[model samples]
Structures are given as structure tokens and as C-alpha cells.
Target chain A: MNILAYIIQKEFIQIIRNKAILPMMTVLPIVQLIVLSNAASNEVKNVNVVVVDMDQSESSRTLNHKIIANDRITLVATSFNTNEAHFYLQENTSDIVIEIPPDFENDYINGKQPKIQLLVNATNGQQAIVGSGYLKAIVASFNAKLIQKVIPDISISKQSNTTISSRYWYNPELKYTHFMAPGILAQLTALLTIILSAMNVVREREVGTIEQINVTPLKKWQFILGKLIPFLCIGLVLFTVGIIASKLIFSIPILGNLPLLFGYTTLNIIAVLGLGLLISNFADTQQQAIFVAFFFIIIFVLMSGLFTPIDSMPKWAQQLTVGNPLAHFISVSRKVLMKGSGFWNIRFEFLYTFILAFIFNGLAVWSYKKQV
Target chain B: MNTPIAIELDKLTKRFGDFIAVDAITFKVKKGEIFGFLGANGAGKTTAIKMLIGLSKPTEGMGKVAGFNVDTEPEKIKKNIGYMSQKFSLYDDLTVVENIQFYGGIYGLSREKIKEKTTEILEELELTEVSKSLVISLPLGWKQRLAFAISMVHDPEIVFLDEPTGGVDPRVRRQFWETIYQVAEKGRTVFVTTHYMDEAEYCDRVSIMVAGKIEALDTPHNLKQQFEATSMDEVFLKLAR
Candidate 1:
């Protein structure tokens, strides 16, 4: 116990004494939060679309007005000829084109479905899907208007059958910053703490101090646990800082239990620190340890369901994601911050993180050598 | 009993797969003795030191360090010894005082004890003025000296040094020996290994390993006479060749 405390104290002192590391660890997260929040949003607005109106009538003008009025679409260009519209599409200047045929008015008057062609760019699959929905809404609204005009004498009721009062639940506005900031905090803690602990051991080996420790009465478990505890504290500090950033800079509401979030974050730090120690035991060089740590972190962050919904992913990918601690953390953080889910709701996530922390840290102790 | 041996080994052997690192060897070091472990490149000096430190498990044989079994009581062995390796062992980014405090803390030293020891070690090394300086910024000689002192922070029964003076200049090596002498004078056992044959002369007794076997073990003077050589280096050349 004393030896472990000594190791923890040593690591903390080293962290405090190093001028470059402390500032870098603290400031990098804030800058990343600001820059990444801007880029990480799922909402893609202002899609550029061109209008090609051959009819040039009131009906065609009204349809064009409706499409442009939508916040999703922006009018980038207008053309009369199909050839000119095709040019805009080919040059990638337009994401969508609404073509009103010359016989569009005739078709409407004759009680036939109007033939308005929507040419959409499918190269960017996501943008294409969204563009199609926007175009369909405009066409549907226009068709309804035509129906009302054509059958004015007939007794009819025009009202929506059912209305959905959607409540965003956790984060009402669905701000990307709110969702991402907590997860990034978790990731930063995992990344930095693990690297430092793993490097601490590797550095000892490289510099020859390990031999000193080896000859001492320090147990392998003591050494590993000592290293793990200090890093765990560092991870928590990073988590607290991330929460502050989310509230002040991102204006993200904290809906979940703050104490619960912190508890889970602490568990996550242990799991990550265990993983780092495992890497430290495997790698003989500081460089090797760093690269291995980076590889695992990348894997954990990507499969964690931070950016995309894990449910939407393939079965195999989802199964692999189950082993990743970040996956559960990202979900749990969002649930608490966005939905304010209680202990029962987040029990499964907490269980997995706790189990992983124990298993990985145990393995680190098993693999650790007090000598040589 | 005349203060039981600090280290005792009986038929200690180590093998990495089929390659024998340290062939079955027997030796003993009395308490407070400065024992030199001398060997040529790949001559099993490191392997032997590792076994003594309880870092490596012997393929065959039994050993005891500070009266603790190498197999079951490896942890106990660690509690009783200090070690310094050939590499830069201390944290390069940590200040001298910070490193001492950390090491002292792990060894179960109280905060007051750590504070007192820090001042004593700094004063002894005349490093009080720059105790806050990062280890990386210090000269190589200074770093080596600090590393030696750090290993002794726990005040162990025996201090194992594996080529602690590698890459250090002769003046630094001499200065390092003075520190070793100081530790020995305090009744702490100094078990050191080095490629520099000149260092063997400083040991109370020396053992020369060749081809994973101890070819000679004696006071440097007696070994020189037995090999018809005036220096430890010539004695090594005669036996190694």
C-alpha cells in the first residue's frame, strides 16, 4: 500500500512539475470542442438547388417559391433550357434541379398528374437522400393546392389526421456540441492518461530506472495499481473540465445525474488506464507503446457510436463495438445530458464499463513484471 | 552467525529457450560487501544480476536475496534492495526534488521523511541550487548521480547496479564510484555489473563470467596474480581468449 502510494505521488509530482504537459492537456480539449463542434453536426442545411421553369406560369412560380423558402434549400441558379440545367448539374454547381415542363399548366388543367422532373445528384449519397425529401415535400404541397382549386364546390375537409408533438427529450435543440463535448472529454482522458502511464513504465525501461524498481520489494500489482490510480484521477479532472466547457461554451443542458456521469467517467478512466498498462507491458520502447495506445484509441473512438447511431451499423460491426468502452460511455453521456436517463436506464452501460475496467486492470497486473 | 549473507545462490541457471544465459553457478556476497559482477558482452552478467534481483525466474536452481527465496518471495526481495540499470532510469520531465518525493513516497516514506531526505540528498550531492531543474536538462553525469541516489531512496539492504556508468565519462564514473563507496560505508551491499574491467578493482571481491560460467571469483589482486597478469583487463583477456 505504501509503495503504491509512493508510485502515485511520484506520477502526480511528475505531472505537476512538467510545464508543457499540463497546459497542453487542459487547453487542447477546449480548442477541439470549439473546432469540432462546428464540424460534427449531423444537420446539413442550405443545399444548393437550381430551378428550370419552362412553363414560366403562376403555378410554376409558386412551386419554385415554396422550394426556395424552405431553410434546407438555397437557390443557386435559374435556367429555362434543359441543356443549361444539365450544365449546372454536370459542373457540380447544383445539388438538385426542379424542372417545370412546358405542358405543366396543361397537365394541371386537364386533371392529370403534373410531369415536373427533379434531377438530383446522387454522388453524395446522404445529400441526395435529404434533397429528395425536400423536393417531394414541395411537390406534395403543390399537388394539394391544385386539388383545392379544382374541386372548390365539393364539400371536403382538409386537415391533418394526426399531429406528432415531438419533444427532443434530452437536448431539445439537438445541438451537436452538447452530444459531442462529453464524449470528447471521455476520449481525451482515455487518450492522455493511458499514454502517460504506459510511457511511465516504458521510460523506466529505456532509462534504466526499472532495474532499480525491479530489485526493490515492490509487487507487480502494487506498481500497476499505483500507476493506474493517478491516471484515473487525471481522467476525472479532464471530465470535469469538459463538462464546464459544454455548459459555458456549447450551452448544452445537463439533464442527467451529474454524480452518476462522474461515477461512470471514473470507471471508464480505469478501463482505459488498464489498457494503457497492458500496452506498456507489451511494448519495449516509448514509441512502440505510443503507437499501440493510439491504435486502440482510434478503434475505441470510431466504433463507440459517437458520430453515428450504433443501431444503424451492421450486426458484425455492432458486436465488435460492444467490446469498446467508449461506445457505452458515448451513449450513457448522451442519455444523461440529453434525456436525463436515470440509474436504471444507464445500468447496462455502467455494468460493461465496470467489468471492462476490472478485467483489463487485472490483466495488466498479471502481465506486469516487478523485475527485469 | 556472522551477519547472514546478503545474497546466496546454489546451482542458479537461466535459459532463454535452448540458449543458456547463465549456466549453473554458485556464489555468496556477505552483507555490506561491494561485489563486482564482471563479464564480456553476452557473458551472462545481466542474466545473473536479473536473477539476483528477482526479475527473472531461474530455469533451474535456488537462490536467496536478503534471506528471501527467489521463487515464492520475489516481492519480499524487491522490498529489500535498490536497483540502477544502464539506461536513464529517472523521469526526464520531473524535477530532482519531485522524483525523490515520488520515489520516497512509494517506498512508504512519510511526507516529512521525504522532505527531510530530499534536503539531505540534495545537500550531499551539492544539488540544492538546481533541485527544481528537470532531469533532462541536467548533464549526463548529474543525471547518473541522481539516478544512483534515487535508487537508494528506499534504503534497501542491497543495491543492484547493472552497467550504471555506461556512456558516462571516466570522471563521472569515478564520481559515481565515490557514491557507491559512500553507500558501502553505510553498510549497504553494492552488487554492481560493468563492462569496464577497471571498475573491478574497486570491488571488495570480483567475479569474471565467460561463456555463461564464472571463470574467476576473488579479490582483484589475487585474481591478477593467479592469471599472471598485473591488471583485471589482462586477466579477462587471458581467460576470455
Candidate 2:
């Protein structure tokens, strides 16, 4: 135990003495939180639209005005010809082209349903989908208004009798930043802990200090524990700072339980650090360690369901995520922080992460050869 | 006078696939002798030292370090000996005192004992002024001497120095030899490997290795007489050629 303390102390001293690591630990996460959370959002805003109104009717103009009034879409041009609007869409100047067929106001007054065509740029499939949804909402509301003008009593009674209201449970606004911030926090902690621990042991080998330690009477498990403890502390400190940044800077709420978040974070960090040590054990140089760590971290982050919904993923990919510690941690963070989930809600995540921590750390210790 | 045997090797051999890094070589060292291990590059001096220091396992042989079996009792051997590598292996980011304290702690020295030893070491090396300075800031010779001191901080029965004075100035090299002699006089065995033949002359007895085999083992004077050479360097060249 005393020797372990000495090793930890030496590691801390080395870390503190290294000028580059301090700022990286403290400042880089905050910067990533501030920049990546906002930047990583998929929410579409100010979508450019071109409207072709061939009807030349008051109702058609009113529909065009409604589309323009909706803050999500920007009406870049109003044209009478479909060809011109198609040209704008083809030129990539417009994301959506709306065409109202030439229908007399008489047909609308006579309760004849008129059809409209919408051409969306599907190149950016997600943006196009969201833009088309907004367009549908605007047209639906405008159709209800036309009914109110045409038949006041029927429209009022129909609206009063039946309504379907959606209440977004956790995030009423559906702000993507609120969803992304916690996952980004998980990603940053995992990346930093894995990379730092991975590079550390290999660096010792390269510098020949490993030979010095190997010659000593230090046990293999003791050496691994000593190396892991300091980084674990650092990882936790970085995670706490990330949480604070999430709450203060991003206005993300910490709703469920702070202690629960911390508990799961500990398990998550152990799993990542263990995998890092495993990589370091196999690597002979710092460069090889970094490259191998980079590869794993990239795969872990992408498959972690941070940016995309896991349910929407292919079946095989979803099955693979069951083994990803980051996936489990990100789920726990979102559920606990946003949904106010309790321990029982995240018990499976905790169990899986604990098991991952055990297997990975055990493999790392086993792979580290005391003899060599 | 019967000085107890500190190290014993009987047919210690290490083979890597088809190549024998350390062939079946046998030797022994007395309790307080400076035993020089002389070899050219790739002559397997390091492989042999590694096996003795419990860093590598011998493929086929029997050996004991500090009276502990090299094969089955390496951990016990580790506790009884110290090692300094060819490269200065001290943590450059740590201070001189911290490095010494760390080694002392790893060797299971008490806190108070480490404190006392730290002071004695810094003062003995005349590095008390620079004890708090990072090791990388020190000169190469100072680093080498500090490394040697740290290896001996535990006061083990045997201290292994592998090319401890590789690149230092001639004056520093002579000072390092004086320290080795002082250490041997204190009744602790010194097992050292060096490329310098003159340094071999400083050893009480020396072994010259060629192609993973010990070609000759004797005192420098006897080796000179036996090889019909005037100096240790000529003896080494004659044997190497």
C-alpha cells in the first residue's frame, strides 16, 4: 500500500510537472462542451423556400404569407411559374419549392379539396424531412383557418370537440443541445481517460523507466492500480467539471440524482481506463498506443448512440452497441439527467458497466507481464 | 577467509528460436567483489544481466541471485538486488529527492528511513542545493551518479550497474569507478557490464564475452598475462578478433 502511494505520488508529480497536460485536462473539455454541444445539433432552422403561386388567388397568397410567417422557413422568392421555382430548387438556392395549383377560390368556397405540390431537396435527407414537416404543419393550420372562414360554426365545434395535444415529457422545447450536451460530456471523459492512460504506460516503456519499476519488488496488480488511481481521480475531476459546465453554460438540468450520476461515472471511467491499459500493455511505443486508442475511441463514440438514436440503427449495429460502455453511459446520462430516472431505471446500465469494468480491467492486469 | 557466494550460475542458457542469446555459461561471485561483465555490442551481456535481475527468464539453466533461485524465486531475488540500466532510467520529470524517495519507498523503506536516506544521499552527492530540481535539469554525469545512488538506496546485497558510465567525461567516469570501489569495500557485491576495457581493469575480476559465450574470466592482470597482451584493451581485441 505504501509503495502504491509512492507510485501514485510520483505519477501525480509527473502529471503536474507536464505543462501541456494541465491545460488540456482543465480547459479542453470546457471548450469542447461549449463548442461541440451547440455545433453538433441537427435542428434545422431558416430553411430557404421558393413559392410558386399559380392560382393568383387571395387564399393562395394567404397560404404563401403563412409559409413566410413561420420562423423555421425563409421564403427566398415568390414566382408565378413552376419552371422558375424548379430552377431555384435546382440551383441549390432553395431547399423547398412549394407550388399551389391554379384553383379558383370558387372551388375552395364550394368545399372542393385542392391539391398542392412540394418539392424538397432530398440531398440532405434529414433537412429535407424536417422542412417538409414544417411545410405540412403550416398548410394544415391554414386549411383549418379556411374552414373557419367558410363554415364558422362547424369549424368551431369540430375544433372544440376533438384535439390531440403532445406534451414532450422531459424537454418541452425539444432543444437538441439539451440532448447532446450530456452525451458529449460522456464522450469527452472517455476519450481523455482512455488516451491519457493508454499513452502513459507506453511512454514509460519508451523512456526506460518501466525497466526501473520492473526490477523492483512491486507486484503487477499494485503497479496497475497505482497507475490507474491517479488517472481515475483526474477522470472524475474532469467529469465533475464537465457536469458543472453542462449545468451552468448549457443550462442543462441535473434532475435525477447527482450521486447516482457520479457513481455510474466511476464505473464508466474504470471501463475506459482498463481498455486503455490493455492497449498500452500491447503497445511498445507511444505512437502505436495513440493510434490504437484513436481507432477504438472513434468506433466507441460513433456507435455510442450519441449523435443518432440507437433504436433507428440497424439490428446488427444495435446488438453491437450492447458491448459499448460509452453507449451504456450515454444512455444513463440522458435518462438520469433529462428524464429524472431513478436507480432502478438505470440498474441494467450500472450492472453492464460494472461487468465491463471488471472484464476490461482484469484483462489489462492479466496482459501486463511482471516478468517482462 | 571464506567470503560467501553472492551469485551462482550453472549452465545458464537463453535461446531465442535458433539464436542463443546467452549460452551455457557458469560463474560465481564472492560477497564483496566488483565483478566486471565485458562484452561487445550484441554479445548477450544484457540478456544475462536481465535474467539475473529477474527481468527475463533463462530458457534453460539454473541460477541464483542473492541465494534465491532465478527461475522460481525471481521476486525474492528482486527484493535482494538493485539494477541500473544503460539508459539513465530515473524519472526526469521528478525532482532528485522525489526520485530517491520513490525508490526507497518501492524497496519498502519506512517513511522516516527514506527521509534520512534522502538527506544522506543528497549531501553525499553534494547535490543538496539541487535536490529539489527536476532530474532533467541536471548534467549527464550528475544524473548517472544519482541513478547509481538510487539503485543502492535500498542497500541490497548486490547492485547491478549496466553501462552506468556510458557517455560521461573521463574525469566523471573515474569518479564513478571510485564510487564502485567504495561500494565494494562496504562488503556489497557489484555486478557491472561495461564496453570500456579500462573500466574492466578496475574490476577485481572480469569476464569477456563473445557471441553469447564467456570466452575468458579472470583478473585483469591474469587475463593480460594469459592473452600475452600489455593492457586489458589489447586482451579484449585479441579475444574479440
Q: Could you report the DockQ of all the candidates, in the order they appear?
A: 0.60, 0.78
Clashing pairs in 2: none
Error of 2 at A187 (Å): 1.8
Interface RMSD (C-alpha) of each candidate?
2.5, 0.9
Docking quality level of the chain pair in candidate 1: medium
The sequence of per-residue lDDT tens digits that candidate 1 reaches over residues B80-116 is 8888888747877788898888778767788888888
A-chain TM-score of every model: 0.93, 0.94
- Indicate the docking level reached by candidate 2: medium
Model 2 lDDT tens row, B47-89: 9999999989889989988999999999999899989998969
Error of 1 at A104 (Å): 1.9
Task: Count backbone clashes in candidate 2.
Answer: 0
Q: Which candidate number has the best lDDT?
A: 2
True contacts kept of 2: 0.83
Q: Write the per-residue lDDT of candidate 1 for residues A1-372, one digit (tens) a residue.
A: 766767877778767876766765678778877877778766667588999999988888888889888988899999988889889889999988888888788788887877888899889877888888888978887887877887777565646445458888566687677777777766666777878878878877776666666665566788887777877777777777777876899787788789988888888888878988899999999999999988988888778877777998899999888679888888888788777889899998888888898989999999886654
After TM-score superposition, what is the CA distance of residue A317 in candidate 1 from its true location, in Å? 3.1
lDDT for residue A372 in candidate 2, whole number 0-100: 54
